[model samples]
Target: MNDINLEKLRVNRGAHAAPKKRRSSNTRTWIIAGATLAIIVYALLPKPTAIQATQVVSAWPSQQYQVLNATGYVVAQRKAAVAPKGTGRVEWIGVSEGDVVKEGVVLARLESRDVAASYQAASANRQVAEAAVTSAENEMQDADRNLDRTTLLFNKRLLSVLNLQDAKSRKARVAASLKSSQASLAAARANEQLAKTNLDSTQMVAPFDGTVLSRSANVGDIVTPLASAADAKGAVLLIADLNSLEVDADVSESSLAQIKMGQPCEIVLDAYPDRRYRAEVRIIAPTVNRASATVTAKVRFLDRDPDVLPDMSARVAFLSQAVNADQQKPVMAVSPTAIVEGEGGSHVFQIGADGRAHAVAVQVGAVLGGVRAVSGNLKVGDALVLAPGSKMSDGDRIKLADAP
Candidate 1:
């Protein structure tokens, strides 16, 4: 009876285990099929393209009147490369780079010991010649007295003819000696002046009131009038009158007619684009560069700041008239990249709040710095796609790559 019960239990366990294995296999197959279906649906769905967007802003009214544009550099009309008068080792420097200097202020000094000594010797020689002149004059006075006495005696027959003749000859000789001494004194004075001038040359001074741009030669460096040798230094320092700063721009000859003396201008430095400098045309070259067909123009700054430096790259916007404070008022503008040429006209892809693009027609105007003025159905706060690429269409959704 016990054996029969054991066999029945084993049969019941086998029956339940077979069905569970089949059920688990079916469940795994269904899970894999569901995953594959979900992937197909995701692959066919529409996706948004990534894009960059920017907001519209106002532009200066004066920018609209810009007739022409040119690029050039800031130049100091009174700049100079201050060099020594002669070759000498630099002993001292009184000014450094960026130091403000006044005209006649000493900027540096060469090893002037030798020149100073020569000047002292020349001064002493001049004094010696002066003393000799005094001595010669005294001797001539004594000779004149003797001659007068001898003449009186001769008239009284107390002196012989030969003695009177001797006295007169002596007086003439003394006068000759005095003249020679005076000539020596004059020559000595001239020598002294020459020595003094040479000594002064060793002490380099500012040629004009300006700011020092660089110190080409330092202490112990051998500086010369010119860098004739490879080892020799040329200029002791480079300086420029900051107040005399101007923009030397190269304007195309075709646009030369747009510029004239005293014409209003807006200057923008490449280094500092945010700062706009008011300027006017100071000179327009009478000739044009044949090779480039560009005319050089000098523009003077109406107001300047310390940041304005020589050699800074700059751009000049020639205006039709002077810009008033109110003319600086902003206008609706967008980046030039936002504009796209179509058969209809120039248009921009303006992004609406609904995440869709709307093609809007615009009248493009003068391009200022990085943006161009555009009159259209747009507001200052409107968002527009930057560099709208192909496949972008009206009502197409976009995923902004960046925040405005």
Candidate 2:
């Protein structure tokens, strides 16, 4: 088969054919050109410039500032339920809801009339016992004298032995009776003291200087013991020291690390939108609430106002940095869009006085609202790159959007 093919077949070369590997070489050249064109197109695409970016200088009252935000309710720092210490029917309300009273001032009274009457009865009984005790003392003295006489008679044998023995027995009986009367008097006095204690407990008094939040009881209303029958008897009055106020905030567990005792905070109440209260973090609960993935934080106001009422909705911001009155200074700020990512870190492109774009590295801190506080390489009045697209580069020419 090889001999026949060699005799009859001869290969033909056409114009389309070229020198050895010419097709491969041409294909490689086209590939290179296409790649070059792609790069050129990419480079030519229109992009934003420094003029497009809105920039501001770095200046802030304090460089380090933290605004940790959470929401909570205002609570009374010192709250108490004004309930009767001893249970009884309420007789009179000396104070009503919204009434402000001093500590130890009676807000209400129970039906202590029965207790008073019982005390009086106990007093009468005590008086009778005292009288009996006096009689007993007289008898005791008589008994002692009789015993002495009996001893003398027995010693001298002036009286019969049976008569002396009878005299001694009579004296002993009178001494026992005197002792009994003394015990009765003491028991009556003890009963009177206990009754007085119960009667005194029947008076419900304000535990501290506070305003009554509620008046749970009125004349003739029955109140029971808080421990034994609290379910059946709710608190008679909710009193709280309004001056002692606190913020009970719930912070997410992830942000709990930022919280600590004495951390400065800014609290805004929904009830008062225009006002802000200065506060400090007083407690950061160590235990996390597993179910809610939150932690309870308590804050105390450095300055309190009476208008800040309990249960007011409040927003809390725990600050890692604080800005005191003396430390407050104005910093040039711009829209957040002005900042951009650069080689080593964050940078900003600004339009210089000559109206040229320049990339400068900037130290960035907390991002708030739509502005970022920046430091280094920028100053007030410098034109910042609002949002320079990919086409922007250092040393690039720029013009403000509305420039002539």
* Candidate 1 off by > 4 Å: 1-55, 148-164, 329-353, 356-404
Best by lDDT: 1
Give the RMSD in angstroms, all C-alphas superposed, for model 2: 17.9
What overall lDDT, based on C-alpha atoms, would model 1 receive against the true structure?
0.90
lDDT of 1 by residue, 289-320 (tens): 99999999999999979999999999999998
Writing each residue's lDDT as its tens digit, candidate 2 over 1-404 gives: 33566745756666447665797998899999999999999889654342554647544444345557899999998999877766677778887778889998888888888888988888899999999999989988888888789889888988888988888898888889988999999999998888888888888778889998887666877788664654345568899998889999999988877778898887779997656667888888778889999999999888869788899999887776665764344555666677777668887787777667888887876655457777776677777778776667787877788776
The prediction achieving the highest TM-score against the true structure is: 1
Worst 10 residues of 2 by lDDT: 57-66
Q: How big is the RMSD of model 1?
A: 6.8
Q: Which stretches of candidate 2 lie over 4 Å from their true place?
A: 1-64, 85-89, 149-171, 225-233, 321-404
